[model samples]
Target: MSSRPWTILGVSTFAQTAASASMSGAPFLIPALHHQGLTVAQASLLVAAPVAGVMLTLVAWGWFADHVGERVALMAGLSLTVLADVGAAFAHSHLLLGICWLIAGASAAAVPSASGRVVVGWFPPHRRGLAMGIRQMAQPAGLAVASATLPAVAAAYDLRTALLIPAAFAAAALVAVAIWVVDPPRGERTAHVATNPYRGDLFLTRVHVVSVLLVIPQFVVWTFSLVWLVDGRGWAPAAAGLAVSIANLLGAFGRIAAGQLSDAVASRMRPIRWIAYAAAATMTILGLIAGGPIWVAVAVMFIASVLTVADNGLAFTAVAERAGPWWSGRALGVQNTSQFLASAIVAPLGGLAITHLGFGWTFGLAAIPALAAIALVPVRDERPLS
Candidate 1:
């Protein structure tokens, strides 16, 4: 109800954006990796490194957040990210760079694992949807930052120099959070406070599964859009990067719109279900038109970016609200772990598929998972936030 929660949300969003830049932003370096003689599939593996690391460590970070506090978790994670980024910036070998990225990803997991809890703890249910929606903007906003800067920097300088961008973001965020972020107050511990939200129902599990399915298309779009534009359409790398950056910026707003819709409808699952349907339809349409006019394909790609990411805040709010305050951190960890697990696989497989099947068919195939997610949304299982 006060400006304080909004301030916390702002800092938390920036922190997560820093982490997202380290995690998802790595893909922007794919062109540089290709010029270094790595194949598309191989370059995608490097892009996958951070996501795989995030998948491995999210639950541990979540547990740390639950036991410690969001501010502590964020500061620790961002600090480690800065260190890992420095290692990545100086690493000469591909293997060493991948390892550094993995470490950065693992460390950056704290932002998402803890930040969602910060929003939920601070905002009431009626406004939590919008607040979390704004919080969810961090991902696409991070991608936008990466898309706009990393490719240009990599093309102008060396890959090592470009790698410092995320490190700078993390360092700046570390300072902001250290100065501004305050952990939301908690109620006194009771038996109910410690109870596991996953015990009695399949709700959390279903949400996780749906989220994983949705992540395939989301990652596919972000990971491949730049390459698709440059290599497939014969656009300049800088031009492609600019387009991707604009798309991601628009996608960030889509998250806010989805969040506001959830608040209006008072149901997180419903909007997610609709988003799944929209994603499936968009992917199918994009595939069908992939060989069509360039303008049309780009337009559809932009739309796909918006629809694919719209459900994140809705699902995120659902998970934390369902899990309750005590367990929300770990619950969010599980939620992100599932999505990142799918994301980790999406790159190499997507690259391989793009190589063999072409971007159109591979993108069309992404709709299958989005369609699957629709049925698994668990619309009836949602409960009012405590």
Candidate 2:
């Protein structure tokens, strides 16, 4: 176990954090946007814009990563994202802001799709689960930072100033990756090797479907958590921000733990299936208790939040392994594309449902996708080439 792998993991994690900052932090901007006169539904669309951008370009970036390499793809993506973030910070109108966020989303797609390839390439199968888990933590960790800081920053100054936070992160990540990250060595593939992973395998298909289904609940909860806390439960803005930040922080740990669990059990599907079941159970419970006491609803939401995102590392490890080194980037892109597509839908739709249906019914409806994910996920794990 050389320190090189860990170094790659550390740098990649920072890169992911930077890449994801804008979209993950978008929720934190909602309160300020609401104050600026956007309705919940409109604000939700703002949150969904970047994700929509990511959904659109994820596969292309993944393909680029596979064709070129992780380092180049990551550097290019982060650089573009930084420009988008800066443009977003200065945008005067909602339309301009949304366009900038859309660009940010498109560019940031490079980080997750490529970063996963980096981890899979650098670490062995035995240790890859944990490495990937740590890598996966970057999303929630970025969200956690945004949740904790962005609201207050926006409150203190303005939305534009707060937007610079992600820009700074993107710049820092660009520097880190440019200097430290390198792609692992690749061996020549045989002429008979299949380049397109979707041809004969149902594994990637099932994993992608399950991940897409699972992301609905994840984004629904994430996009509206602060509003739900403040408006639904009567908490102050700062307190709600703190609660969501804490949940995201815990979600990061959950990713790491879920990865280690897969490694310990020597099966990726098991942990993912377990996460789906757990997500279903928790989300169902959340619906049941949605109108209950504030403390109780908060507790249930916390559980649902943690369980919803816990499957990322597990499913990602499964996908990367099944795709092998050859198609890992594109496969991961497809996987994330599906999930982000689901997420793009979840944000605005969930917000609309919350506006019309109330949190109780909306949460109950959100649980349906988690239930679907449980049925969609494969029962057994696929074996990967060493």
CA lDDT scores, all candidates in order = 0.93, 0.86
lDDT of 1 by residue, 1-386 (tens): 68999999999999989999998899999999999999999999888999998999999999999989999999999999999999999998999999999999999998997889999999999999999999999999999999999999999888888999999999999999999999889888789878999998999999999999998999889999999998889888789999999999999999999999999999999999999999999999988887789999999999999999999999999999888778889999999999999999999999999989999998899999999998899989888654
TM-score of 1: 0.99
Supply candidate 2's per-residue lDDT for 385: 32
Output the worst ten-in-a-row residue range by lDDT, candidate 2. Answer: 377-386
Best by lDDT: 1
Best candidate, TM-score-wise?
A: 1
Query: Least accurate stretch of 10 residues (summed lDDT) in model 1?
Result: 377-386
Predict model 2's lDDT versus the native. 0.86
TM-score attained by model 2:
0.97
- Model 2 deviation from native, Cα RMSD in Å: 1.3
Model 2: residue 215 alpha-carbon error in angstroms: 0.8
Which portions of model 2 show Cα errors greater than 4 Å?
A: 384-386
Off by over 4 Å in 1: none
What lDDT is reached at residue 65 by model 2?
A: 89
